[model samples]
Target: MNNKEPWLAVNLSMLFPGFGQLYSGKALKGYILITIEAALIVSTVALWVQGSLGGFLTGFGGSILLVWNLFDAHSSSRSGNEDSFETSRKAGKDAWLGIFLTRILPGLGHFYMGQAVRGCAVLVLYIAMNYALVLLSGSVAGAILGLAASIAYLAAACCLLYITEKNPLRYPLLHIKYFIAGMSIVTIITFSGALLVRTYIIQAYTLPTGSMEDTLLTGDHFIMEKLSYNNVDSTDPGRGIGHGDIIVFTPPGTPVQEHVKRCIAVPGDIVSIKNGEVFLNGAKLEEPYAKGETTYSGIEAGRIEGTVPQGKIVVLGDNRRNSLDSRGFGYVPVENVTGRVILLYWNTRQILKMDFSRIGKVR
Candidate 1:
């Protein structure tokens, strides 16, 4: 026994991790770690091949296992030495303080175990990466990074468990500290992405009806720029729209309903609907797409002639007879103009019915 180098046992344990378990006659545990570590390595490589290298499974789980292995090795050192491994019965005031701070801050646990630079690096990297992920992809990516940091924390607790054999519950406040630290990462990430960073795309509306047919058809999904209507420029609706521009507007009576039509008459222009034809500025508007020579004029039956009011646009659908448009509901207020219909996405029933070759590009 005098010839036995117990420090060799410690060094070997520190080198390979779980070797300390082998030294303690727990060969089963040592083999388990080895098996798990190898399996994770293989799986990580396979996932990288499948193009999920940056995914949560690879980034979070791989990071955790790496830190866990390091901590396991560190704890295994000085395992059997009486002087070096002797644990205090009172749990020691300073030792408890170190553990407490480590619990409060990620990677601080490793620092408390005398791995200073590594601890600080881990803490800084974890925070910076988490912040970046939130900024780019919102909370989804940030949460994964947090879970990885937590695995490191678990490794530290497991090390302490190996050394002290004390109940972690006895350190209730410290346990809360670690729990909060891990949760703090996720909370910051979620809040920053949701409120501060603003990584989501703006909502755009699609034309769901054919009231604006020939310009914007039913089932045509067009992109409306939210930024265009954000600032109301009442003086010159031309700040956003000009002659010949197809505009989308919410009619005066219903705030939520949207109507798309071509701007034939701007503010102060006299507009008249006569014999089913639109007479704008004293000239019969020649719209090639207006299908009928005589409009049913039924939809706009009660409509009367008037000059387009200031800050109002006279918008009409190309389908003169069937549309519920400016003639039916009156002029559209300039403030209600959403944006010009930019693109036509997909016509729902047009798989083999491919009359329109236009698919993606804005009209």
Candidate 2:
């Protein structure tokens, strides 16, 4: 009796690319779909990281596959024709369910497959590994750690899928109580991970104003890496903030808002403006990227500046005449800095008129 529900198959496929096919008794097709989806995803991610336009286009294929999978699962369920290669479902263990859960979180699939102790251990290890990687970000070591973590996650997922398919365990993973518990766990872990990544790894922000002008225009979307100045001595010019570096930080009076500006002078450097030209340590600073005419309107206007106080930095926007930076808000404390802008990945000026050339590293 083919008692499969079409909606149920569609829902399973929605959870993970081949899960619906597996539920509809097309295991061979399901496996093939999963492999193709995985390959597309990995390739897309890698290419995107390298700032390739092809990566952006490659994402369309994944979307197409997802839609097709959903439709196929629904049709297969409605037809009630089980493939000869379909494995017996008499065993309570579901390889598709295990793989889907693992896709959500590494150890979750093991728990669904009746390996409770192993799951718990793997869960703890996965959390610890992620924490360590976050701590190590922004260096060669961090890159290596991230790669190793990816490999480890892939290996664990593969092992869980294989074991669940071969073991035929009587785990009641589909029970309402267990399913709810699993979902709840996944929710908590996912939220925590997102928060951790945003706080310590990287974050995306859009420029709402043209304070940066030629360097960064209004409606430009860029990614800032939080790891560069994290836990490092800001006074050290070699390793910390340096001249001409663009940074994002909370202004002195504005705790709720962030401003992006170029670092003009670090601690111990004297800064002043003569006429409309900036002088750093008694020498006229040459700024080729600066836009518009400079005017003496900020708080530091016409003031004979002394050495920048320790743990402080002088910042100014590329659009000198239009910016409200350290000149208007005073020297920004090192602690207020959130991150350094690394790339301008997108422009939200208009949906149909996006400038693809702007998608590159920020100087």
Candidate 3:
């Protein structure tokens, strides 16, 4: 074999980005030791500059270039010493395989080939980045950041391929380890965040109709707190839906139609509708939001003179005539009640002075 050209490697590495140093047997140069390491920096800068997924163009370009540079350096450094390199290169087939897998699944490629530690780190970073994108600001800029950061992975894969070809016997096991570690970390984080979001934060729901007109208009976007009524333990399931709660529930008969209405009477409460007015416990319940003092004039369907069953609540809309509420379908059971509406955020065009009063506490 010819004597290794250490001087040539150094010159090339120093002259052409990562080449000269790598050719000089400085493995760190072509191995993403600097460029790959700078991935986090690029990501941070991109986020800081663009601020969201929409502004990721700068960072995306930088990332792709960075990855391309790394690959070029690796290729150029291996150009000389063809025979000696050829012998070393044959063992790298498995490493190339690892790199190939990394392209599609990030750290999984490495883990599949058995590089557990590196694969775990990559997987952790990947999951964290994706979580941040989903939770904070889901603009197109975040998408670009994700795309740009992916280039480092490509560089890592390229290097891994070369390394594996140099030592095929050891590459397969390392790749597999990386794949498993990456998958494990990703699975854990994904489910963890899902549980957290589902448990604590409010969810956005769209209101279709104007049953509760002047209060919750149609095309309104509102948020409902999930844990506000989840306090019912196994000891007492009846403690969920209380009186005065604006609940969303499906009536007993037509289970498919979900309606949102104010709960006026709980189980055993005496409810009476006289002259289109609601009476609870023999006293006239004053509704300030009702359009007028009128009874169900033509419709003889919903008026009731009965007691609320156990675990049921009588619900009615503020718009007495236009609404088809519990008066029509009967009372709603506590089990079908999902949660209470805490806020109202109607569409701007649907209501005037919307910007000034778009959001308000729900009745």
lDDT of 2 by residue, 256-362 (tens): 68899999889889888777888898999999998965565736563336788888888889998789887777888888888888778777664357546667656
Give the per-residue lDDT digits (tens) of candidate 3, residues 1-363. 332333233323322345434544566756554574356445643343222332244445555655565455545545555665557544433454455466557787678667788788887877777777665443457645545455455455545554433443333455445443443454455445544554454455677887787777788877655565565664443446666677677788876666778788887888888877888899988887765553655656545567877777788777777777776767677777767777664576646654635454465
Q: Point out where model 2 deviates above 4 Å.
A: 1-6, 18-186, 231-239, 281-284, 302-306, 360-363
Root-mean-square deviation (CA) per prediction: 17.1, 11.5, 14.5
lDDT for model 3 comes to 0.59
Ranking by lDDT: 2, 3, 1
* TM accuracy, model 3: 0.48
Candidate 1 lDDT for residue 205: 50
lDDT of 1 by residue, 1-363 (tens): 111123233333433445545655557867786676667656754443232423336546756764575445434533443552234322443333344455557667657667677577767866876667546442455656555545555455334323433444333445445434544554455445434312221224566677666656677765543444444465565455666566667889998666777777777878777776777789987777664553535555535377777778777676666677776787777778766554454666663487556554443
State which candidate, 1 or 2, has the greater lDDT. Answer: 2
Q: Best-fitting candidate, measured by TM-score?
A: 2
Report the Cα lDDT for residue 312, model 1: 81
User: What is the Cα-based TM-score of model 1?
Assistant: 0.43
**Alpha-carbon error at 257 in model 3, in Å?**
3.3
Q: Give per-model TM-scores.
A: 0.43, 0.59, 0.48
Q: Local distance difference test, per candidate?
A: 0.55, 0.72, 0.59
